[model samples]
Target: MANDFPFFKKQSNNWVYTLLLLPLWLVLYLNLQIIADFLIDDLLQLQNGNHLTEALRFFIFETPKVLLLLILIIFLVGIIRSYFTPEKTRKILGNKSLFTGNILASLLGIVTPFCSCSAIPLFLGFVEAGIPLGVTFSFLIAAPMINEVALVLLIGLFGWKVAIIYIGTGLLIAIFAGWILGKLKLERYVADWVYKVQIGQSEEEEKLKFSERIGGGYAAVKEIVGKIWIYILIGIAVGAGAHGYVPEDYLGTLLGRGNWYGVPLAILIGIPMYSNAAGIIPIVSVLIEKGVSLGTALAFMMSVIALSLPEVIILKKVLKWPLIAFFIGIVTSGILVVGFLFNVIM
Candidate 1:
């Protein structure tokens, strides 16, 4: 009975509920500022001029606005991802030219969202599917760094220019880093047990009804938003605190281009940290507003998201320590160059 159930069996009759709620969601989303102002100014009778009041206003406004965006984007991406299963993705990457595979895998990472926690399982799948290590690294790097959630938040909060620069630089790094790693012939560094582990053949994916696709979207919202909402809130809250209390030019003095050690320091501090783009973007926005250089902030953001300690830890399960170190070394070198380049140019 459970196997026979469709994706949205219960929701098949719930279209009216969904349609009715979308307008309400849109109305609330469109007036988030007004709502935040009403709550802070009118309802709470808080004056707008004070730091505490502004902080509260920011927290109230950003929480809902970002949540709404996350729900929408994650849902849409989820539906799109239903078309790209792990088996299919590996098959696509299999038997590809090393250089081309990195490019394709990096692009594919944009649509198929997988986080660091999923890395071990995905690596096992890659092993079973006979996918190249370099291609898998590209996908892993790009997925968390330039994900749709990050792109949407950057575009929505910052603007198109920042978003484009972030995406462009991110793709290039993923492609080249993976390509370099591939050219090094690092397959010998993988764990012997990993290669020996056999997996069953993947069954063909079934075509689904339109409603099923919609169901996939809802599932994505539930899973993704549920996982990262806290990180988003914490990031926004920190941003709000800095926005309210920190003096202008404080961060600039430390992390701005004026400081010779700024960019490398930011990346060094960021590598051990862990957070997705949605969580880190809010902080990055504050950094920029406080006169932090774009390149430095971006380097920090990419290092936190793409080269997180957690990812490295998980990958250690399948990769020897030497390969892991080289992986970090290569990716860090690429990130450092991007950071310095942008700081100089922009």
Candidate 2:
């Protein structure tokens, strides 16, 4: 059906249609809040300060907003990833010093935003391309944990300070933890299937024409957004529930900064609850407003997005239990340290 649409097909004239349609997407995205407000305030006849009304408004407003952001980010990221194929990544990082490769790979994670499930192919590709385990780990960690959407949302919802802190710590965690894993030389633990698989070489890299990149972007929106939209809806639903009825004082008592156990407890709780950063930010905001400590809240948020149980289960396809356990331990410890340090200093 998509191929039957002239603009959707890969064509020389695709950029023209892409440019023409972007404004329409933007206009609709910008008006979502108004629509949410109308439904909550006028149609539902809900009071402004009421928690139930606020939660419903948030759910209504954020669901579409997050989906739109995911589409836009995924499309752009797909175009970028088109340039950085597994072969290309291997060629570039394959020969570099391990430390340097880990750093570069972690930085690339910001732009190449593959989620947990989507990351497995890249992980396998990296291994097949002869990319080092440590470097592969860096990319894997960074891709989902510190992607552009998460960073942008953090900055928008919190201040630049919070966003910067998250980015810096996330990078550090990916790099050093990958470095540690690299030093451990745990190659024997990787699933045999990953080592056995091979990918064919691709054609030479030429600059894709503008239209081709646009088509690639369109394909990305379809593929990536289609897979994760349901997760986004579910995450937002969970966030809305927390926003609407969770007692603020109870949250503060449990996860507040002064509580020494808050960080680890938050981490433990967050691991079981899966969410993307977009879906979790609304709940984070409410948690902070309710007096949960910033560090603890951040630890909870990161654990939910980056180290969720679902991601661990998905990774089990390639990583054996020991390596997976190690990866989790190192990351969890790093997050705990970050949480404690931030709570003390900030």
Per-candidate alpha-carbon RMSD to the true structure = 3.5, 4.4
How would you encode candidate 2's per-residue C-alpha lDDT over 245-301 as one tens digit per residue?
545598798888789999999899998899776667767877777778989988888
Q: Candidate 2 at 240: error in angstroms?
A: 8.7
Writing each residue's lDDT as its tens digit, candidate 1 over 111-141 gives: 8757677888888897667678898888888
Residue 34, candidate 2: alpha-carbon lDDT: 92
Misplaced by over 4 Å in model 2 are 1-6, 21-72, 113-115, 118-121, 159-161, 191-207, 222-247, 278-286, 310-321
Which candidate wins on TM-score? Answer: 1
Superposition TM-score, candidate 2 onto the true structure:
0.75
